[model samples]
Target chain A: MTVLDQGLTPPAPDLIPDPAVLDLSAARRDVDATLAGFLDAKEQSAPGPELPPLIALLRRFLDGGKRLRPVLCVCGWHAAGGDGDPAAVTDAAAGLELFQAFALIHDDVMDASDTRRGQPSAHRALATAYTANGGQSDRAEEHGLGAAVLLGDLALVWSDELLHRAGLNVGRLEQVLPLLDEMRSEVVYGQYLDLQTTGRLSDDVDTALRVARYKTAKYTVERPLHIGAALAGASPGILAACSEFALPLGEAFQLRDDLLGVFGDPRQTGKPVLDDLRSGKATVLMALAVQRASRGELRKLRAVFGSPDVDEQDATAVRKILDRTGARQTVDEMIRTRREQAMAALDHVPFPAAAVTALRTIAESATARQA
Target chain B: MTVLDQGLTPPAPDLIPDPAVLDLSAARRDVDATLAGFLDAKEQSAPGPELPPLIALLRRFLDGGKRLRPVLCVCGWHAAGGDGDPAAVTDAAAGLELFQAFALIHDDVMDASDTRRGQPSAHRALATAYTANGGQSDRAEEHGLGAAVLLGDLALVWSDELLHRAGLNVGRLEQVLPLLDEMRSEVVYGQYLDLQTTGRLSDDVDTALRVARYKTAKYTVERPLHIGAALAGASPGILAACSEFALPLGEAFQLRDDLLGVFGDPRQTGKPVLDDLRSGKATVLMALAVQRASRGELRKLRAVFGSPDVDEQDATAVRKILDRTGARQTVDEMIRTRREQAMAALDHVPFPAAAVTALRTIAESATARQA
Candidate 1:
């Protein structure tokens, strides 16, 4: 049998701890450890040394993410009254994180963005390595793009490997698979909608929110919770509660992201403020501002929006229009409303006290944080 | 419950006749019908109308290719003495076809290929649709590339879905998963190796052969057989027999492909004859030509190779040099040797008489056909 064909053993029990005692920070640590061990094993079992660089690149790319999905996944397990044996849930959480890495890598390529998390994006990093290794400079960019595509594909497949090896029983795996499929298709459709709307200014707030709900609300929040809850064999009521609490909080999180993309410090967000403005993302904030703008304001917005040469000065002008239209304040108000709604949904949730407190904390931080 | 969560029913019994009675053309028809039904169901059950275009695009793209992998998978099943229900094997075969679709779509994107199977490549087709649908002309190309990336990702994931729903028992599914993983990794690595070598003239025939073995031989031939054999719980000896026949035949198939890329009629091959030469693909044929060329011939080859502007006159000159150097003849000899080896290996195979006859026919057609 191939090395990969060898049966997987469960992670050490001590690494997982009791779900009742698992806080977000502890969960993050366990998830990180699980990811590290998995990647290490992959490296050791790799067919050749040629793959280490790719594994290293993935590991580095993975290092800087917030691990938000993993934390929520573990929280969902607790929310389902699961009190022990967090190993399987943690494994699934690691799988989600790898899937996120895959998404981010491909997204960066699609956007042609140069930086992610304050580092050269996957394609850019791979290009740098190509040149450093004596590959012709003229071919480096194309090679890097190709390599990044392969890397993303690998991560996507390996994520499946991780999920399958999460040690779930057949029934639990069956329950989780459909949710995973839904999550995957939702995010892809969301990206397609986003791609279609990008570079074209529009005042359709409903379309913007629909994209946000599909791309962020369901993908980033509800699905992970549902997947974890499914692992615990939670009732449909618990899964429905997850949707209620997750959807609004997830929307608020993205709304906050929209504001941060335009106004947050580069040091804080690890991305340039002008990218969203230059791309002319069909964000709710943009739609709101466009809908309410005066003729002159609309002309100014159109002049800077979707321009590849849009600069900090152009961004400053755009911000003035946003503020003058009260779009900034409106987005803030929307975030507040959604955050409160998310918390209010939590009040009726049947989760234990610790889980409820954790979810509240996540909602507050998710909506209110600058980055 | 969600529509996707519903357990998959088996294909109609009539579609999957007794293994001994299976006809290759009938198997192809059944596999195609299964694919059509699966995709139709997916389209109807999609979360929204927005996804129909994507689903339809995939269906059209899948329509044009020869279902080689799927056919080989069934052949392997028969070779493994698999009997009665062919439902699971056919489902897995369909999954292989989707995986191939994913590979080709992404490969076309990486190569910036304008056409595939005599039709516009995925990105090109998408770009045309984008413009036809009134998307901004300037952004259409980028949008197409992004959409194609998403499309490939969707195909990859959906391939996994098809495999999961292939109705394998848990034990059989476990057996198949690692082979699937290895197949995925091998093909990606093969593509990476090809990417690294393309546009750089090299005289390393071994490296070229390595690329062929990994990229086409193993991926296009060996793994599908192994996956099908694994599905039937084939013994090691039977699996080894599959490899003994598949590897050499697969190599000969690629060797024949190299010759066809240069010399075969475009009407027959459905690909431009100049693509490989213009791209300076480091094929075994090219490597042999380079290795044996005189200094003037080498200079002439270098001048036209990898030149996008090289025309029919330059191609004729290159062909003359290739003929003088006997590279074309060498490749023919190589194909003949490998084909004979494949046939010889099959003589010792443990498969039943019908499977043996079918495999011999496949080996001949795969290497000898113009396409």
Candidate 2:
């Protein structure tokens, strides 16, 4: 059973409190140093005249983003009764982070998102660069979009290469390759379903949640943890349990993100309030609101839901409909319910007490964060 | 050094004849059978209940493209002293063709081309379906583009899965993996340079040709051969010699294509006249035209080139300028010269006379093909 504490709890078989945490600053410094060395190696391979632009792309897109995926992957491996060199885990985890870069770049372009991680998105950044360098204004946007698309392709190809070269054994290769392939395929399929769901919101809340679970939850949490645990040769039962733990946590994370998209501080989100309302994204909360709204509320939503020229007043009206229908409270309750369900999954996992404790802390922190 | 007559060509050691001409019916039968098996497997993996749309995409985009890469790849293996099972080579070559599928889908989106292989391109087809299905016009177009981009990404990821499961040995894996990675990296770099070249006309013919050689020739030809030969554990020197032989031939192939893009019969090329001119592609021919034109001719070019709104009269004016400025004949001469150079390289390769003779014939046939 998981024991949540600031310090390591329920120590596993032969487990001790990570002494590294005693000196938290030094531990953070070490991780940063390790990451920097790896990035430098990546940069060196892409150096000189012909490849510098692509290399610059890697650096630009990769920098300033929290390496959350990699850290989670490495920690998952460590928590799975695996130990050798932390560096090896870091290298393997870097592949996951690179895959993240690939996904985010393509996702932004597909979504026509102008910014990501509080900065100009890759396509917009490239378009700005093209314009600043006196490229054609009309075509610069298209060129930038095309280049970003190609860059994402390059990253996806190279992520495979990186994972292949991660010094893993044949056994690990045999186990992980199919999982990774499945993850990649399902994520793309999930994206298609998401884009497909936009204009057709005929599906109920259950169906919308299923789409959200596959499109965001499984990808955002379960896959990375599985990759790490698989590298450590975790048993299938354990992996399944880990996924069970991850899924609800992931769902809650996205639910929180949906709330932030609609109601969070604009300065913190780096996006305007009700951006999802403007985009008419078919969120689980929105679908619930549609199902519960009165005749008048339904009329208001129908008027403003997908109009491209939605004004601030339209957004406010939509928010009023959400509140009046109690959709906001219902979603908040759902998030808490999922978060508890995720913790219950953790309780079922027979991991080491320290790892279980750390994981519980992570789950709470990840889902409860404001931005 | 090379033989033209069928009887005069010595029997190759392990070389296969050109599938296009020799045993044409049998080769067509094999391709048809293999493609059927592939599509059947594809359908089984992506179930209709969940992924019918994705299956339809593969059916439409990959159904009838010319299997030139597969044929050339299998031929390259045989020409390089490989005596592996044709089925294995076919499987491997089919992976390359799938890769080509991925590249074409994305390239069509990037170039915003309306047609591919004489049919509506994937995005266009999807957009047409969307509109026909009574979807919103703007949303349908964006969704089509987004879906196509992700579909390409899916194909690319699947290509790697195909390679990993092909049941090759460690030595073959070592050679093939590096070549595949380098091929991917170089293709992206070449694409970047090609797009960059559109902004300025270079005075140096060699630089322009180098761009063409890398962007089209190497990817379209040499790398496929390299992949096959690497699979066969061909000696380093032999592989190097094969590249030496293939590079110029590949360049000639693209040069011939560039020629066809401009002035060839629509029936032969399966594309309209001035396709390249309308696209404002800075091809080797265009670069030459820029360098060769007089002041008035240059003014005419500057007015007409790269103007997306150019009318039919402007297109005809550009074509007339290409003829009057001798750009057409210059490109023609370049193709012939490159074909000769390629043949010259084959003569210097230290392969068996029988193999060399077969290689020479294949090279000539590739350059002389109508489509």
Please name the candidate that would achieve the greatest TM-score relative to the true structure.
Answer: 1
Q: What TM-score fits each model? A: 0.90, 0.87
What is the DockQ for all candidates, taken in turn? 0.54, 0.52
lDDT of each: 0.82, 0.68
* Residue B210 in model 1: lDDT: 85
Model 2 over residues A70-94: C-alpha lDDT tens digits?
6556556655765665554555566
**Residue B244's C-alpha lDDT in candidate 1?**
95
TM-score per model (chain B): 0.93, 0.85
Query: Which stretch of 10 consecutive residues in model 2 chain A shows the poorest summed lDDT?
Result: A1-10
Clashing pairs in 2: A10-A353
For this target, which candidate reaches the highest lDDT against the unseen true structure?
A: 1
